[model samples]
Target chain A: MNIHAIKAIYRFEMARTGRTLFQSIVSPVISTSLYFVVFGAAIGSRIAEVDGVSYGAFIVPGLIMLSLLTQSVSNASFGIYFPRFTGTIYEVLSAPVSYLEIVIAYVGAAATKAIIVGLIILATAALFVPLEIQHPGWMLLFLLLTAVTFSLLGFIIGIWADNFEKLQFVPMLIITPLAFLGGSFYSISMLPPFWQKVTLFNPVVYLISGFRWSFYGQADVGVGVSLAMTLLFLGLCLAVIWWIFRTGYRLKS
Target chain B: MAPILSISDLSKTYDTGFQALKTVSLEIEKGEIFALLGPNGAGKTTLISIVCGIVNASSGTVTVDGNDIVRDYRAARSLIGLVPQELTTDAFESVWATVSFSRGLFGKPKAPEIVEKVLRDLSLWDKKDSKLVTLSGGMKRRVLIAKALAHEPRVLFLDEPTAGVDVELRRDMWRVIRELRDTGVTIILTTHYIEEAEEMADRVGVINKGEIVLVEEKAELMRKLGRKQLALHLAVPLAAVPDGLSAHNLELSDDGEELIYTYDTTGERTGITTLLQDLNATGIRFRDLQTRQSSLEEIFVNLVRTPS
Candidate 1:
């Protein structure tokens, strides 16, 4: 209910993103752009297209999702973790702000940053690949939902991580590999029977597939199921965060 | 008038089973400087942390202006401004922005004039545009105080506001604190400096072993506990005290050069006249005599050493 509090926290975080411009926005866009060049040259020559889209265009949605997931998680996680590291979190915890408002401000700012990065990558991708949007509304929805979900996950990681080394553990050891194997580069349908079945178990596959379906109208799974899975993950993150505040875990102590 | 803040049976037992507080209770008047004095690991910080809601209380009830700190936390917290012991602030943000942002965190509407006034009062108006990382340690401490005052709370808790600063900065901080107190803000500070309490606090609370050992008006406590010592220099060294002076509380110096007598400042008759007459009658002559009163530091040490 404290609107000013939320704005203060939100604006402060957003200002930090602006301050670390290269690390926050430019690096992810540039790295995703490099993916476009290397994959377009190396893989585009061998395969003409995956489904009806060109090989170059096929990875655009997937690459954007890759950066979105990573940046959202890292941004929200570091946003909270740095405060804890410096012992400045006591300021926010003692303020008039509630736990839900704290979560909303941090996660919302992080998602906003991730969404902007996703849009910029989309624009950058257009310079190389001939892309088409089948459903712009659904694409926006997918982008917003994925950023919020991953940012919430990052918020949890921030609280659970006690040290700087542990802060980078999940993004490096778990998320990157999942993004690579989640059909971000090549469609899971192109793999053999057993490998395709194995790829389906990776949760990232559902996110990317649902997102890509809104682009080319073709996907590895039904759009409805992918949306449901994302909501389920979002709910799970919410439950964990609610428990964190209720029990005063890591934050209150 | 009701106390601005009231705490009853407050306690905190950490997960590790360490009992940090044991049924501690306190009340703060609306416009007075109160000091909590204790040594390290004496739970001064823990007690403040619980009242500020940074640490959960194991069992207690706290009301700030009739607002329960736990049940109506938002309302209660809005009235409090805490300058914590640790130096923690956003190094990236400018002084003006951070202080302004802190005000908003208390749900107060934007008032640039108030922010400007707080900055000027803290002697930080010149550094308003400077980032915190660029500021000196003393300046950062000032900024922390400015941030705490940004909300204009009725009660302010300064937890060791002058811990590591130099003498000049400590004096400056004390002046700022006194100025705040003059504006009718109830100031509660925790410190290990007996001098600080003697110089500023109207009431002093000595906390030790997770309990308040003593709380009394500074003057009253000093009068009641303060003792005066009289030392007499003997013209001729004596191996033992004179038999006539046996009734007087006296101690012989090991070097056999002086006699010491201790007396209470609050006692109407210190018996000094009779003791000196008895010494003269016993053929004891003194070249010089000096009287000294015990300081708050000695009183604090004695209080902490004894079981409450």
Candidate 2:
């Protein structure tokens, strides 16, 4: 409801991201570029094609998703964790802003940053391998949804964590591994049948599959299912956040 | 005029079963400076935290200008600006940006001129472009005050605003606090420095062990604190105070079982030795005596006891 307050918090967070461009934007961009080089160039050269697309191009969407997920989590988690770490959250807590507006500002800024990083990485990938968007609209949709969704997850992680170590814990321990196992480097179909079924249980598989579908008209699962799973995760994070503000969990008291 | 902030039967019990606040009740009038005085672990912060909505109360309620702190939190909170005891700031942001952003957080429209005015008011305008992390501790404290004032609320709560600052900064902070009060903002501050309360407050509340032991006009609190009570156990149960001892400031107990002496603890002499000699001469003997400094009776004694 307080649009001005949201904008204030939003611009401030975005400014912080700008001040630490190296840590916030550049580091992730560079790391994803490394993934493109090692996995796309060296590894893809050994394999001629998968699903009728060059291996280098095949991993493009997946690699972008990897950085998107991690960057969203890190940007959002640190955005909030730093305030809690420094004890500046009392300002926002005592202000006229509502819990919903606070979430909108923080999560919105983080998602925007992650999406920007995703777009820049997409640009960098174009330098290495030829790329195409079979469905440009869907590509943007997948990118926006994933950024917003993961940023929400990151917001939850931030509120849940009290220490810097814990802030980094979820992104490092849980999300990174999930993305690696979720077909960010290879299609899940390439796995053995039993392994493929086990990999299906990983929620991130839907995101990458739907995203890759938007890229090259290929996917390990239906696009609808991917969209559904993403929305489901988004809803779950929203519910948890609502409960957090209601109970004042980790934030109010 | 109605009270600006009213708290009734507020209490807080930590998960560890430590009762930090027990049924605290207080009313802060509009435009008056009120001071809350208590020692460590005395629930001073707890009470402030609850009223600011940082710490949820386990019982009772708080209302700011008739808006319930819990039921109508936005209305209640929008009226309050808090300078927390801890020195916390946006470390990477410029002083002006942080203060302006705090104003926006209170849903106020952006006014760069007002932001500049707040910065200048705190003498932070020169450092407006400086990153917060680069500023000294005193400067950072000033930024925190600026941020709290950026909202320009009807009431201001300063929790230990000068706890660790130097004397000069403390004086500057007092000036700022008084200026805020002069503008018709109700001010409530907590401090270990009795002199600050003595110098600034119109009303003073003393909290101890999670309870408000006394709340009165500053003058009354100071007046009550001017003396100590020494109870003398008597060897003989006299029918009345010895006529000879009437001039020595002594009162015989109802049954003459003890002699109660009231004396200014701050006087050049307590006159105890002379009183004892007079008692000996008056044929009045005492078996035992004890000096007590209860909350209401010895507030000044404790004030003078503080190392300043």
Candidate 3:
């Protein structure tokens, strides 16, 4: 299993987060806090409630999901991509570690970082609004599943991207917008009937809806469907990763 | 004893349609310093990359200490270490951390003493805590070597270890390499610097156009392919080489003050005595004479210049 190798890589990646504390931990915490202040305080003042929950508290889970999704993708992708960019990937390729171990180390570390950020954002949200968790176990499970799935997707993007601009392409242009439109700031039901259907198509919606359901027990979609959708996406990411390693796509030549 | 590393009929045709290696086969003995000498783009890096598990071969097999590189990669790769040509390192990583990380990457248990010894051997102990980007180029090169050695592999491949370093660092690196060889580590280095091979290689392999053209003991290869030249300084100037000395195939200096005689080193007879006798009899008097042997550089140039 090369457990030592996996530990080494995981520790190395986690250490990088420590080194870039401001960017990795502090920046996300501050930005999500702003989302709370502006959206939860300024905007929630106008709307009394959504789904029988205070508007300010209603957005907490969604806001946390937004950060978790983006952070997971960026962390995992950049972790792998920087090594490729700097040519340090040669050492990793030549080492005794297996491809599965490499993926576990990188994806595991990315997910860990994203979960930490998610928890910190949740704590920050508590400072702005009264938070509740009807199903704490479900909430944790959703956080874990969503972080791991997005981190795996991020790992694929890291391998697929050949340049810096492409590295930013997914997180900035695709994920952030998806999270915004996937019910981060408001419920998907608040959207018109047509746009609500369209919002369901965004994968981020399933993740956020599942997470929000765990928090308030009031979800736009059935909890079981959201859980199934998250698992389905996780399986898809795993399949793509398996194919990538098997074919040596964008990794070996 | 069986060879520490063995490669057979290895070939690689990249997706770009460039054949980097063509049916290459070679064996490196344990604890010997073997040098793979070749020009740029001669597949030196590709061969190393394949054996180290960085690149996959299109065909053939490589075994490290009898472990097949493909089927038993973990064991095989654990037995080998590679210091790649490029100076690729994490700019933010401290020297100590990176070296330790490499050791762990090879599935070795944490051994601070071993890492310390490697760092000290490479003269990197003082900069152990410094970030990689803060180190000089030469120091970074040393760190790469340290990283490769951190796992204590049986075989080490150094790809152009001293390409752009200054003379002092080159010599220092050579000394470190020798020290490693003395510790019974099999070293296979790829270089175009003929002198590096001449100075350190126990055996030399010449690869050209994706094939190994020759592999011989350093001293034996020199004796077999090396040529000798004898230059005679004439006491008096002459207009041309005398017709009588034509049998010796002598070449006269442009100013006609010297004569040169070339002969194969491996031949039973150098013909030098006969040439001297012929010179005296022909009244070609000389003030002084000197003999020079062809270096590995000349032999290497000649080897690669010709179609194998």
Highest lDDT: which candidate? 3
* Alpha-carbon lDDT of model 3: 0.94
- Ten residues in sequence with the least summed lDDT for candidate 1 chain B: B206-215
Q: Candidate 2 residues B232-257, lDDT tens each?
A: 99887888777888887688788889
Tell me the tens digit of each residue's lDDT in model 1 across B137-241. 889989999999999998899999998889999999999999999999999999988899999999999888788888899999988999989999999999988
The alpha-carbon RMSD values of the candidates against the true structure, listed in the order shown, are: 1.5, 6.7, 0.9
- TM-scores of chain A, one for each prediction: 0.98, 0.98, 0.98
What is the overall TM-score of model 1 with all chains considered together?
Answer: 0.97
lDDT, residue B150, candidate 1: 97
Put down candidate 1 lDDT per residue, A62-95, tens digits, no spaces: 9999999999999999999999999888889889
TM-score of chain B of 3: 0.99
Return the DockQ of model 2: 0.75
lDDT of 2 by residue, A9-42 (tens): 9999999888889988788778877887887888
lDDT against the true structure, each candidate:
0.92, 0.88, 0.94
User: Model 1 segments beyond 4 Å from truth?
Assistant: B233-239, B252-258
How close to the true structure is residue A132 of candidate 1, measured as C-alpha lDDT? 96
lDDT of 3 at B118: 98
> Taking the true A–B contacts (Cα pairs closer than 8 Å), what share appears in each candidate?
0.84, 0.86, 0.91
Candidate 1's displacement at residue A178, Å, is: 1.3
Window of ten residues with lowest summed lDDT in model 1 chain A: A40-49
